[model samples]
Target: MILGKCPYCDDGMIEVREKEVSGKKVKLYACSNAHWTTEDGEMFELRADASCDFRVWQNSLARYGKWLSYKDMKDLLNDESIEVELISKKFGKKTYYNKHISLNPEYGVSVIWD
Candidate 1:
């Protein structure tokens, strides 16, 4: 249960562990205080019920170039009526201006180019 500060509940620490999700083993972090758990290390929490065709989004981003912007995904997901929970007050500026947003390669959220 090694963890850093809880991304969801800043007051509590996080506990990193592996759990089966959607039939796959995912290493997710859970808040020590039971605030939240996520496969993305709590970078941002996309509600489990969020509905959006990830393939469509991935294709759309590919057309633009390499790397998908968080804002782009957030906007589309929001339009699709998917709720996104942000641990941080704002989507970090790192992805602004095609700066390449990071995604977990294991999750296959987007295609990777070698």
Candidate 2:
């Protein structure tokens, strides 16, 4: 279990648990020793809850005609609400910006997000 640091708590990876409520069971990730909630009883998923961060960040960056550094990309990936492992398996590493050439020749060239 290689866990990334949680941005909100500035702590290490989150803890996962499966709990039963009513007649349904759901998986949730929370801080290692902290429970966060509002007076409204809203729940928050840990920083690692989703894997869309990569796509979100990358797509945003690419749309703005910018290239993200590897470290920045990693940060984006660590803050999603989905399983990054699964996301990685789908998108792989580099994205092919061009239908034929993928930001080759010039890595930082501006490109639109798919």
| lDDT (C-alpha) at residue 20 in model 1 | 55
Model 1 agreement with the true structure over 1-114: per-residue lDDT tens digits: 433443323365544445554465544444445433366542434455433212222332343333333444444323432222222224543232322332332343433332
lDDT of 2 by residue, 8-107 (tens): 4454454444444334554333335444333332333324444321111223233323434444434433533211211112355634333211221123
All candidates' lDDT scores? Answer: 0.37, 0.34
TM-score of each: 0.29, 0.30
Report how far residue 33 has shifted in candidate 2, in Å.
2.7
Candidate 1 versus the native: TM-score? 0.29
TM-score of candidate 2 to 2 decimals: 0.30
lDDT of 1: 0.37
Candidate 2: clashing residue pairs, number: 6
The best candidate in terms of lDDT: 1
Summed over model 1, clashes come to 0
